[model samples]
Target chain A: MSPPLADLSAPPAIRPSLAARLAARSGALTGSTAGLALGHAQANLAVLPAVYAADFLRFCQANPKPCPLLGVSEVGAWTIPSLGDDLDLRSDIPGYRIWRDGELVAEVDDASAFWRDDLVAFAIGCSYSFEEGLIAEDIPIRHIEEDVRVPMYRTSIDCTPAGVFSGRMVVSMRPLRPPHAIRAVQISSRYPAVHGAPVHLGLPHLIGIADLARPDYGDPVTVKDDEIPVFWACGVTPQSVIASARPSFAITHKPGTMLVTDRRNSDYAVI
Target chain B: MSPPLADLSAPPAIRPSLAARLAARSGALTGSTAGLALGHAQANLAVLPAVYAADFLRFCQANPKPCPLLGVSEVGAWTIPSLGDDLDLRSDIPGYRIWRDGELVAEVDDASAFWRDDLVAFAIGCSYSFEEGLIAEDIPIRHIEEDVRVPMYRTSIDCTPAGVFSGRMVVSMRPLRPPHAIRAVQISSRYPAVHGAPVHLGLPHLIGIADLARPDYGDPVTVKDDEIPVFWACGVTPQSVIASARPSFAITHKPGTMLVTDRRNSDYAVI
Candidate 1:
């Protein structure tokens, strides 16, 4: 019916991220979703029992830079129509990390079997959206060039506590030349739904990152001598909070494996 | 027809910048313009003969970051109506530096004696506009806090050559913490007419500045250990170029004493 896909060699950006979403829906995309949807906004998935949804929502509202909410599903609902027409929350993400009592218990491609009637899913904005914004302006993204996950660090900056949700803020790093770093701030500031501009830059130890190579989450990428590390409040921050809050049952997209959304990245751009 | 002025003890920002402009016109204010008119856009004056105006205009166009043009008067004209209703080129600035063949020959309170029929006055955008924007956002300005001139440096970064105008870029430094640095970029980027965003930050040595303590122009303020220096392309670049190109006769505002225009800083903001 679809003419068997006309151009397989076209760049991922040229093809809609819907292709990645469809592949994920079929259990074919079982790994990272970093470059798969270059143009569309991707989302970090967070699922928790309905009992914890209100406080988690309050946490997101309190710490907007780290937990910018893209959408939240009704209890037990798998689809958020505003994000996509065909998005199935339980099976759409490439991978999911199941947590119990603050410990990661399982990693799975399909989350359908673990779904409960009281489950509530939140689609948090991802840095991948702003990464696309940076790349559009010809600012180099080091982690993307190195073909690795963006380096994320747990910082000494604490998130504002909301009921039971609280933890240190997590940040994603991108090393850019000074001019590009300034330009990146301008470009990323337009997409506040994602992490927004950078939270910290230049001084790493001041934010409690002792060594550049040792990242708390995601792989370490090359930070050239000529470049200064610019940091954005990361989506992984919610995951860190979940671990700290020790919710009885929770789930999240595996680091770097995001929910490829139908929404264009520009949808979240304020101006 | 106007009522008597009230609240002299109130902050200078409470009064319109026109107050400062009128003071300069009346010979009542003849020192640095800093902190005099806080919310207005001030300008750097560059008066040159018609023979060199075209090349200098090209230089401003070529290197907009360093020499953002606010208004260029008609050849031999002293008034830029767009910048102010009653701005006079000769006596409206606190001090003027008279240059002869690239040498500083005289410092005068008024340049009416030096006005020539072939002279063209160029009003370049000053960082004071963006500084007001930064201060409005509650970001502290270090130089203003210490009551000293902002530190300026000549960078190794070369300007795009335009005929007889060619020289290194000059930049002004403002030290801020990491979060404020990112915010400053966003705030300043909106005021493209006034140096736009910072050209460099973090590593000063990379831009050829050997010591932060010794600036090429202005006084250095204390850069706290927690703060990193953010650099903006400065209005001083045009004066530096005048020295390098050695235009036979030129007139410019003394470093800190700018042409305080009636125009509000918001007039220069893009969005």
Candidate 2:
């Protein structure tokens, strides 16, 4: 027998992200990129001077869970062709946070004017890929359902030190019932590049997070009494580490906003 | 260059369970078999009349997490050749519990006297296999450390019913810090024939477990303040099911005691 009509009528499973990338470059999509490019992988951006680039690379290597490096551009390059053929690091992301001496100086739609010959862009994997996996498994995501940014906190767990890039790890939280929490662990482990499995779950205080309601970054979603607060190593770790390291100059994507990439999310599923 | 002398001096990593199985068969090891066979796989036994064997097999198929059938013997047969070359179902286990009309009537070192010509024996995977995997990965098991039986409880989660076989799932609990809990999930997932990953974690009451201090089957293990109570589907589910179903006659391994098999735990590691 032939396949069903719906299967024949359906488009390819993975959608391309070139249009979204172009929209960001044109300053027409200057907001949170969450759910913007379905089936495409999103990335956390980090641009630093060549002097600190090698140290940051070591940092990511030593602490892969929180800083999973996807692609890195050569010194002074504005594009990482491996991530996307038309990917322009300076303006392909809808939002950018320019840092001076580890302090956020400005948030802008374009970083082209601030781009310099010494800048090196590092693309780190984001949790959106695994979140998509969880959603596909019918696991409900609290932040997505509530229409709010995921709750993130500063954890007491220290990252393995590498040069000046050292700080406590930051984690994003999701509240799920026990069964779904177990399912999340299995599903997320398949995508090792995207923070992998949770770093902590159940007891928050053990990880040094005092209050689930008062997050260090992003907005808090309701955590039901019966639910477990599962925490994953957040991509925001690099930003926090940069803030602590006090680099003379650095650039990162604003929280909740990410660089949309041309790669399919399925490519990141290791298993 | 030749390998180190120590490598040549060391014996094979996986030790055979033949001696341990022989001891049980001879009635020399008439007690708990928790650590009797170090590198071998142990199984929970369930013997039923041939009339109920088909329904029991369907029940196991419908609820694999709780009743992972490792092997089954022919009606009136006493050996499962696949599990062991000379495995005698009637006397290979360290201890046996005989049930009559859903009530335990006797606990004996060997079931040879009670063995019937119309019975079938089932070998269900036990957690001891994955516990070895967890220990190999340096994940501490609380029950082993405390020298107590791993706690088993009756949960609100119901198993898929088949004919006269039906009951709520029974789970084994282990207290672990959040990080270790996550690691245990990943490690156990590789051995799906042995209960696979956890069914629930953290909140006990959510699974109808009101208190951690009291368990329905095995002795309770200490749960640290910083640790999360992780629960996995226990092989004891079949025992509970047989009891609730009020079968005319049934046989099972006593709590904390099991049937020593020739199969290495590594043989069950699917990944």
Candidate 3:
């Protein structure tokens, strides 16, 4: 019964604690964070030069639902106190994508060699925060159940721009039946620190998504006839903005992979 | 450019305080309580003889989202202290529909003539609690905007039957674009004392709703091409149960007319 996509996904193995997961990333484990570090917060990383940090912070704050800011590392310092101890942003993510002049220049396992004193790192919350809550509620996340990346799409809904950062919002997609989607929206709303609730659903065309089969980013999952695509503002949005608003140099976690942190997702839930 | 319906509705006059609303109802100034006693709790009334009261209470407890029990009057007593000190089951609601053998026999302005010591009253929370929340958030409710009764439908989703009480769930619908629907889910989830979250959305067929244009109950709201019908469990569900349960003697508030209490809607919000 093995499908042709068998090589496309890895197993849901026993994950390390937040600290161990970060340490693994620090070493040479270049991969996604889908099923790793089960109970802790995993964030989308975007490190920009000090010059554009203020504008980017405003962009994140203005679009809180899509770009929920979880932690911001001190300028020139690689550590964020609230995230973890001994957490060096430069080398803790599974991989880093370095962008220069609005193009990806290279993908690397460690960013310590690229660290600059004037660089500031921003950790925005991801849907993984509420995925834990969803799983705890016994709702099956389709992509997670099938062992694939959550589909991501670029939408017509525009994000309020700040400084050099401005672009359409990017969203992650999940497929669920009517009742489950209703429950998902209710459960996800409690974690506003994550991408809370959905931005678009059912009628994807209204949001300018031309094809669900071909996502703008991430691997596509099967959509059942009875199910509708539910979209959440994605963490990839900041990365997309970094690509579009290319500074002289910028660093972000490779898509799918994230910065696993010491903080628990429950700490950020509003209900 | 005002329509005939608008002119008729415009003279609802000054919105009354809770005290004024209660006094009007008690004095047989019978009318729909919608938009009256703003910010106060308006409830769905269900009165049954004491012999079947405990089993009916179990039915409500089993289905809290649809039949949120606000308060229950003591056997033969007219007042429910938790809902209001002056609350009278027989006359506190502007209008009442008397049922015999599950068939509506007649409507009455005041039930004081029919009041008996054996009758017990149950006050159930209403979706009006969350409507205030939605309005506060600037999300437009279609029926409220159109000044029509909120559209309700009898769905195939069944409520757990207790004793002689059993029937399909009744859902009140409001049409909104996908994003607003998501926000409604979050806002309504805060008021579990009302019908919390939603029973269904997007695909009405999944819930046995074959047509949206002709609802079994309430006026049809205009669903724009870009809008989707979002459904919430309605307090009318108990009324639907009465229809199927075929109780020999039962009384309910006439649709649109409700019992207004001193308790603020905010008092029932969980978060």
Judged by DockQ, which candidate is best? 2
Query: How far in Å is the alpha carbon of A81 misplaced in model 3?
Result: 3.2
* Candidate with better lDDT, 1 vs 2: 2
lDDT of 3: 0.86
Task: Name the lDDT value of residue B165 in candidate 3.
Answer: 85
Q: What DockQ do the predictions score, one after another?
A: 0.79, 0.86, 0.66
lDDT of 3 by residue, A50-164 (tens): 9999999999999998899999988999989898866778888888889898899999888888999999999999899899988998888988988988889999988999999
Q: How close is candidate 1 to the true structure, as a TM-score?
A: 0.94
- Tens digits of per-residue lDDT for model 1, A1-271: 6568678687666346667878987988888887776678899989999999999999999999999999999999987888886788888898999999999999999888898999999999999898888887888898889888889999999999998999999999999989899989989999999989899999999999999899999889998888999999999998999998999999899988899888899999999
> Which ten-residue region of model 3 chain A has the weakest summed lDDT?
A13-22
lDDT of 2 by residue, B203-250 (tens): 999989999999998788888898989999999999999999888999
> Can you list the residue pairs that collide in candidate 2?
none
Q: What is the interface RMSD of each candidate, in Å?
A: 0.6, 0.6, 0.9
lDDT of 1 at A241: 93
Per-residue lDDT over B1-271 for candidate 1, one digit per residue giving the tens place of the 0 to 100 score = 8998998987666346677877877889899987777777899999999999999999999999999998999988999998887778898998999999999999998889999999999999999888988888899999999989999999999999999999999999999999999999999999999999999999999899989999999998999988999999999999999999999999999999999887788888899
Which of the two, 2 or 3, has more TM-score? 2
- The list of candidate 2 runs beyond 4 A from truth reads A1-15, B1-15
* Best candidate (score: lDDT): 2
Chain B TM-score against the true chain B, each candidate:
0.93, 0.94, 0.91
